[model samples]
Target: MNKLTTLNDHYALYVDGSCLENRDVSATTPAAWSLVIVTGDNGLGKGSGEILEETWGSVITDSSDSAFIGAEVGSNNTAELTAIAEALRWLLIDGGNRPAIVHTDSQYAGNLATGNWKAKANKQLVAMVQKLWREVGALRELNWSHVRAHRGHRWNERADHLANRCVNNQAPMPLSFWKPGQR
Candidate 1:
């Protein structure tokens, strides 16, 4: 297993984003960003794993967010940046004081947040996420980690599922653990 993919094992924060516009770029289609966050698991039963939030925003005109998203909101990079911004807001509200890493499959999102890469395409969205990252960092320890997308890792899979749900207009649901004839 690659070291990067093991972020779920070490960090409490994992965020993922999905964009519908990238998938179908039809002129009439709405490009929405679905973001999912996993805080961590406590090694307990049904309530062990806690997902902080599942957020969806229209890249074109998501009233939930400010108008700063600008004209390139339909881009996948913008969607990924939106997810990181949301996660940072949640961490600020959740009062995360300990060290935590934000895992993302989008290299653009991770690098922009971590300052490892400069923003060339989605300047507004990237700046927004970087701003949020700095704000969140002031309140707590934060790290950025990039992972391979579409892998079968536990948290990543769940994050991807939640992100896709927004495009499908489906609400986030709990994972079913019961299996028939498991005994």
Candidate 2:
């Protein structure tokens, strides 16, 4: 019966879910990348009471391009994080920029993004995200933030939809969503 409506609520969800990354985020760089992750059960409603509940999860990643890129129905946190990180990588390299912000619906993934925390629950996915983060850093801007699910935020909602597509294996491949004429 919880409905997310504000950034504070999203932050609260991350804190309450043991989902927030537990790492040291004191490093500073001259890049600006904003990542907003949206994770939660698929088919979840906004406290409508009549909506059915589903146990599916998804995540979205976007940069300044305004294009939607993400995945859905992750088998676990690792899978979801990997999907999101990969999407960011493609976007950054193709977008031709430095220092990028990465958004995710997963606190676990967020932790890995900033190195404020390490991936313990899902080692493989964590490794994947770590690799992608490094690659993105080598290319352009990289920022990390966690967005609460079903919060109704424009980017977050889009991410949620994209993530759902990913979880369902319905998302377009990274290359498919890539913008043309950008190496």
Candidate 3:
């Protein structure tokens, strides 16, 4: 069973390898209306018995021009995408009278959001993400981009690191450690 644990907010975060920034939230602070999404990968291989990890991030310009809103983490593309959408829903939708933009590294997610492509095998996921996007989009503009991973974007680099950390921490132990007659 997964026990309750105190999670470090810094665990899946990247800011500048040099400095960490704090994100503050307030009841009246408006959401980030314009944003960018960046993703990172560690080259997981299902074949040849290799498995890698994924990470995600978002950067936004909040109602207060001086504040830049952002978040990043380690996770798979699918999970990361969902997390991004949900974050936007909370920040952009739950907040009143605000519109915003969403950017992403997943062409699959971006294309579906803009009606540029059809859903592939993951119809349920597509539908759910789309629903969230539309919900938030209703309040703001959501434009997406499919940026190449690890091309030296500051936010993308941090997000990638976080994603890799998440996957690395959750990876399954090697079969060599199995005990005799273990199921």
Candidate 4:
């Protein structure tokens, strides 16, 4: 497998989105995004490497409170896309040049950000994510990979937990407070 296919020898960022009521999502829907950055060799594996940072927040509108007023609506896909965008933004600020890889369980997010699929909805959000992807790529080596969700992947699971915590209006857990395989 190519380097992109493998999780070793690179900084890995695992991101996830959570929406408790995804069927009929709206501006008031309980949705959030979270990302976990890992460092060291074989960082993707369970109980290995260090949890460098864990960040999460609720999905809210840009300005207007009304979803009908061109404000962002909270949904699973939007949360997922937002997670990727926020991850890229984090990298731009602190990622340095360490060949980084972003792992997500949402193929919709991975494909759309990588331009492998066209976005029929959420055009504004998708465009923003694509722009961040390009800007990050211009600075360093960046790659995006899709992982199966809720399949016992360590960092992915942690990201899911964090996102859900935000959806439930809980505070983010500190980086030093969590270790690999804690949950």
Candidate 5:
């Protein structure tokens, strides 16, 4: 298990994914991914820390079909993987050199990205995320932590909400500027 390096300035990114009709997903299914980046570590509770950034969007598929353009050909796994990729991409480009930890509820994603489990499906997406993980490691410390879903974990629940909102075509909440403990 890769442990997070102790750092006061490290960032915590809570990510989640949502898919509409997951069991019946097809080439036109809707799925979305979201991430909430924060600082501080009062544990992973509601007031865990102050929100530094929040982002959510449709999950783009590897397919080139126009009908399946944005989030159409997506599944829960794809959304989960994409959320991780986007979070790492953000850290690589805009996160300075600060160490960061990504918290996710998907054990599948966590295991695959950290080499704890071999991927049997979605090889391409898995490869992309693994590559990005390596790239981010080259610059600063990056680690993954498994967070249980829907257990009232603040940022994790927020990420779930944002992803669901995106899947429903609703506007995302402005959590980036939201102070801790504010409803």
Candidate 6:
């Protein structure tokens, strides 16, 4: 049985979007993103592979951003936004109301989330993410920051792995460990 434990009131999430197909049109390629929750322990949180002290990894099924100019599937931007939205959504539903610091290697994702950048292409998709963040703000404080990619950051590496797993159509390891509300 999973044990009840006191968790940090806040979490740091390293998010990455991976598109290994290297196609000009994302519609023809597979792309994915991941958000790895950072904890005091280097190991997986409490059970199986819980992201934080207690949270599940999210897999986004919708790859297309059909807003403004419809974004093709497997686009790195879409994947990044999807990861961010899923993280906020999960935090909202979990009702932990804990503050979150989101780290993204993509300057666009980080800047846009923090209102430092404007969307010129995927306007609709950006709007949707903005809406989600606003909703998250009602329940928890959210901060956005940028991180250098391929620098050997542990959480970032894990997130990168998760993103690649999605591209390969493989499930994130944590999903096989436990289900939300089960432990």
Per-residue alpha-carbon lDDT of model 1 for 1-183, expressed as tens digits?
A: 123333344335556665664763432344445554654543121234566665555455443545545435455666677777767777777774755677678887798877779987767667777788888878766787666676555566666666666656776566565221111
Please give, for residues 71-147, the per-residue lDDT of candidate 3 as tens digits: 22212334344445544555453465332333344566567645567765335445665776667657654444454
Question: Which regions of candidate 2 are displaced past 4 Å?
Answer: 1-74, 165-183
lDDT of 4 by residue, 1-183 (tens): 136534455678899998887887776777889988987636444647777888888766555533221226788898998899889989999857767888999999999988889999888888888988999988888888887887777788789889987888877565568653333
Please list all clashing residue pairs in model 1, or write none if there are none: none
Predictions: Cα RMSD each: 6.1, 15.2, 17.8, 3.7, 3.8, 7.7
In angstroms, how far off is 152's CA in candidate 5?
0.5
Candidate 5, 156-181: lDDT as tens digits: 87888889889889886666554332
The segments of candidate 4 whose C-alpha lies over 4 angstroms from its true place after superposition are 1-9, 41-44, 64-71, 172-183
Query: All models: lDDT?
Result: 0.61, 0.40, 0.37, 0.79, 0.79, 0.62
Where does the lowest 10-residue lDDT sum fall in candidate 6?
41-50
Give the clash count for each candidate: 0, 29, 7, 0, 0, 0
Instruction: List residue ranges in candidate 5 displaced over 4 A.
Output: 1-7, 62-72, 173-183
Q: What lDDT score is found at residue 69 in candidate 2?
A: 33
Tens-digit per-residue lDDT, 47-138, candidate 6: 22235632223233345523222334557787787677766766677687667777678888777765678987666657777887888877
Q: Which window of ten consecutive residues has the lowest lDDT sum in model 4? A: 62-71
- Winner of 2 and 3 under lDDT: 2
**Cα lDDT for residue 129, candidate 5:** 85
Residues 85-172, model 2: lDDT tens digits:
5555555545655333444566766776557796555454466557767776666545555656556534444444433443344542
